[model samples]
Target: MSSNKQPVINKFGVISSSYYEKLFKCNGQNLYKSRSGKSKPSYSVTRECILKFNHTENLREKERLKEQLTKNILRCKRRLGLRTLGSGKHVNIPGGWIEATYLAQCKGDIQEEALNVLYDSLDHASFDYCQLPALFFVAESVLYRLCCDAFQKTYLYSVEMKLAKIGYLVFLRLFVFFLHGHLGGFKAHLLRLQQYLNVLSLSEETYYKYPNIFSNVAFILKTSEIIYERVLLSESTFSPNGNTEGYENVYSDMEFQRHLRFNQGGYEVNHLLWHCVAAWSCVQNNSPKLNNVLEHLNFHKTQLQNKCWLDSALALLVLAEAAKLNMVCLKALMDLVRDFILSIMSAQNQEESYKVNDFSWAWNIVYTYVTILAEICLYAATSDLRKTVFIGFCGCKSSQKNISLKDTVSEDEPVLREASVLGLLKYFSSKISENCNQLIWTGYYGLVYNLVRMSWELRGDEEQNGLRNTIWQTLQKTKDHEKDERIRIAVKIAQAELNDPTDPFTSYGTKVPPNVGDETLSKYIGWRIANTLSKLFFPSIDACAVPLKKLSIKQVQRKYPKKKEDPMKKRVLHFTVREHPSKSELSMFPYPDLFTRVDEQLARIVDHHWQEELKIRQKEDAICEAEERKDKELKEKNHFKEIMKKREEKLHKQTKPYELPPRTEVISLESKERNVRKVTDYRFSTKIVQLQTGILKLPPSAIQ
Candidate 1:
């Protein structure tokens, strides 16, 4: 394994050089670089083209930009070794979108493989928001947008009359997931999908063929679209809907008695369940709509209890947000999570070793549930981020205070911080420390990986709280027993991170302040670790294969600890990262955990220190201001004498000076003072200006 500087624990090994670089050569020049200079990173050109395509308003120019972007994407796909279908008109391929392009896609079986990776990438983004999803979506968006662009440019005729492109199928898959619809900021990703689908819903050609299949897709599509727009509309304002503020019209509600379902089984879209989730997210302490949204949410309380993929995803999202709000929606989530926790406990009770496929049915629901719950626990337990709370509630200071930071617990709570998240950590820890660790490792690798990542991230006195022991035990056991070489390699990387004190990943944009206490420093490191939590969730290649992936870093490789050395003996852990990573993909800072805020206690300490420093500076500045005032008085006396001397010089130069006479510095009293403006400074007032003017007209006797 390479040193911490390189992302050595990569799930998918780095993408290497490819054949597309020569195909997109502009003006017959080398695509790699100018003969005289360095070239742009692979992603740089494609990203620039995407930005241009979106921003350019000119039709011909926009088309040209789209052409260039298409080429860049194709070049990247080939570079990443991803399959591409060139263009449907590429002569070899017949139907559907493939790879990174909208107009043409890689063939079916190959595209299915790519699409799996794409879905995993999408889930990862909604889960942790790492840098890779940004890359993946950039390419994904271009493909979709270009396909939409081709709706006008290319032929829609097909022999079967069923529909030629399968791109809308991709849109259906994403629309079903809500793609961070729980968080409410994933509008950009879904925005293109809705537009394309809306286009198809209206298209005469599309309706003429595949009418039945697409109608089902369109019905759900419009319903989901309205729900997102309603929730997002609340986010757009400082006030609730129908306020006397910006826009008055409330988003019209779409109604469906029962969720629409297909004959293919369990594939259902519940308008009510999803609508409630959206409404609850926008509900605030003083929201005028809060009572109404809650009323609707409770009305659908039965659907919330029912087990479905949509409900499960929405439940997990609410559970996470509940933790942030000190369980604002605890009553609602307790019912959902109670069953979830039991399932996890049940999975553990199994004696025989089972592969993930042993219970393929349950794995789908439980794997995502555990991964996301583990994420909630990790952020809540290790980092000071929980102190920041939700952004929506911040505006209501009185309302914010009503909510507590700690969980509401009984007297006999576990030894950990009564935060339920802490207990969950102990539960995961018990899995490692106890004998049945093998059960979880197979079915829940993401959960195992998240725990180890949490342990490494909680690099302080906090680790002594049972986490340190569990992490060490897991790493040591995996080094010898793990069959998957990737797991073994990953375990070794964890071991290296623990042993190497000089790691670059340790620093998370925080500097150890001068004269900082041990407790404060520990808290500060917890704050710093918040930035790197996303790296632990590395699931293969995140973004599309771009030139940026080919730009590799030279890192110092890691060597295993010696047999003679004490493995437990440790050097101090350091923490921070570049605060402002470059806009380019070459920047090493992971994007997912970038926005974790400072914890309350840490914020208070820094604020206190800042206030004291501000006072001392104020005192020093007072003394300096007095000294400057004395100097100004002395200078003014000398200025009067110099002015008289200048008068003599001006008197002598009046006959010959070529430069224009000095402009009047004084305002004329005869000139009208516009509209009753009052003078705030008496020092600037001229005696020549009479009291009759707006500068506080002086009395007649005072004037005399």
Candidate 2:
């Protein structure tokens, strides 16, 4: 090797002379395309090799690697530009992203140069008269990086101008990518871009012309609209007691944000999105026409048959919203929602362990369904109208007071709320009981949310004591074995909420806490932002965040009162009380002779089944014996008939046909004659007797 050349250091600080030769042999674009060697050029490679300049001890090697990385970025950009400007109909999306990654990882002049190359290529290259959507994404990514760089350097003006020139519509397309928490400072750009798009009045044609580009535009618009309404509603009805500092900050932030709010129509992500938008709009206005919208959605609920799970879930979500707004009856919608969820779960119960191609998407659908059911149940459990509706459904002779749909549901006695809460608890329990491998983190999250929220809501109501054990057991199972961090956090939050129902942070993804005193304006704002973001992108771990360690088990225990043993039941107790439930205790309710009861139930069931089997066997045996007896009798009768028939044939063969016919004819003729003679004789005897008597007397002439 020449003296001017130097060996590069690997991430482990080992001198890799071969790797340095390899870097010079091929640039990143070629190396990435052809990776037959052990060291693959991934995003991490660029980060570790060039980004970490201090990895190498040699200054000359460091400078050489930096120059090499810049040249590689330029080469990658050149390749990307060529491909973007190519006349080929189909462009390699992955290849473009690989180059974009290199550019994203590069710094200083190299990053700028790479971004410029992408911009110029995308701006001027419009082969076949239409710009490729792939190329546009590449350019947007580069520009997004540029905006981030500018923001980091406090060049806000340049960042704004760059985004403006790139267009807000383009930023909307790129928004979901940032939602995964990869883009740190660039998320601020989302709100600003939202503001800009909201202010600008884009025509229907402008949005509709490119359906693919503006596919999620309708959702974006509706989301913005709902957030705005919620913000106003929060400000107007702001609570100030719990966490007042957070509340002030949230209120001030929302009040400061004056984004344009309008209901826009274009392509929606799905039919569910459309209905949700319409439902939110009608719900906010308290329009009576929401009934018609609900009817429309119900009419199309049959579409779930042909559609995917997402559509089925979205349809349920719309119905749930309708129920929430009181446009549809809760009782009717609950049955539909419950059945739909069960059906979805049943469909996913394949025996084979198949890897999901789109686990995130599948998980999202399940999560969405679970959350929709949870919200519906929560609303029904809390709302007074729902209580009245439930009373009417149950045929209770309760007064039909006219309560508005928007009325705050007062914490009433358990009778009115028990039905809804019990139903919701049953749903959560059943979902948690499903196969662990099949259940996703989001599903668990929703299930835990419902459990904890219901437990919290039903606290202090003695009627829910039995259900507390069930909820506690489920939380324990989830907490012990949950692999997903998000789900574990949710379970922890639910447990915390169960411990202290007064905690404001217990409400993970919703604004409404079980204890209203703990709720604040900021918490509600957080809920709204988290929820909208979760739906817009996908569910995130932070979306349903609760306070970390602010709650302690000791505190919860302090509030929980010890139960006095029932003297009558204690006589039957054979077990000792422990501080915490054992594994078996958690699996089954820790009650005296619980296992004995379960064993008894199982024994009775087995005995019933065994008796049924015995009866069936006896019936079958009796039927078989009867059939055999009938068959034997039939064979004997046939044998007797055959013998008689043979004898008759022999007799007929021996005698003439006249002799055989005479036997039947003679009997018939003789019997007829004898009967005739008897009738004549009887008449003659009676007449003769009467004549003799008459003759003996004087007047016998008429008889003669």
lDDT of 2 by residue, 537-649 (tens): 22122332121112334456789968888777645445656756577757443443544465568779888999999999999999999999999999999997787678678
Alpha-carbon RMSD, each predicted model: 32.4, 30.8
List TM-scores for all candidates, in order: 0.30, 0.28
**Ten-residue stretch with the least lDDT total in model 1:** 516-525
Question: Can you tell me which runs of candidate 2 are displaced by over 4 Å?
Answer: 1-269, 279-292, 302-322, 327-336, 349-363, 372-382, 385-421, 424-445, 453-490, 493-704
- Best candidate per lDDT, number? 2
Off by over 4 Å in 1: 1-173, 176-268, 271-276, 282-311, 330-335, 343-359, 374-419, 425-447, 455-704
Please give the TM-score that candidate 1 achieves against the real structure: 0.30
- Per-residue CA lDDT of candidate 1, range 1-704, in tens? 34322212111222112323322333333334532457743343332343445556798996676566556444444433223212221211101112233222222322233333333222222222222233323334433433344355544232111122123333333333232223244545344345545555555454322232233233334435544554344443111112122212332332121122222222334434444344334432334554465555455544432333444443445444434344344334433444444544455456352243143234334344444444444444433333222112233343222222123223442232222333333333334322334323322244444445445554553433344444444444433444554344344433342343433233422332322111100121111111121121111134321112222222112244335767889877655457555558375545442112223356577779999999999999999999999999999999877776786687864322355545452344323353234453443465446434676676789779
How far out, in Å, is residue 272 in model 2?
3.2
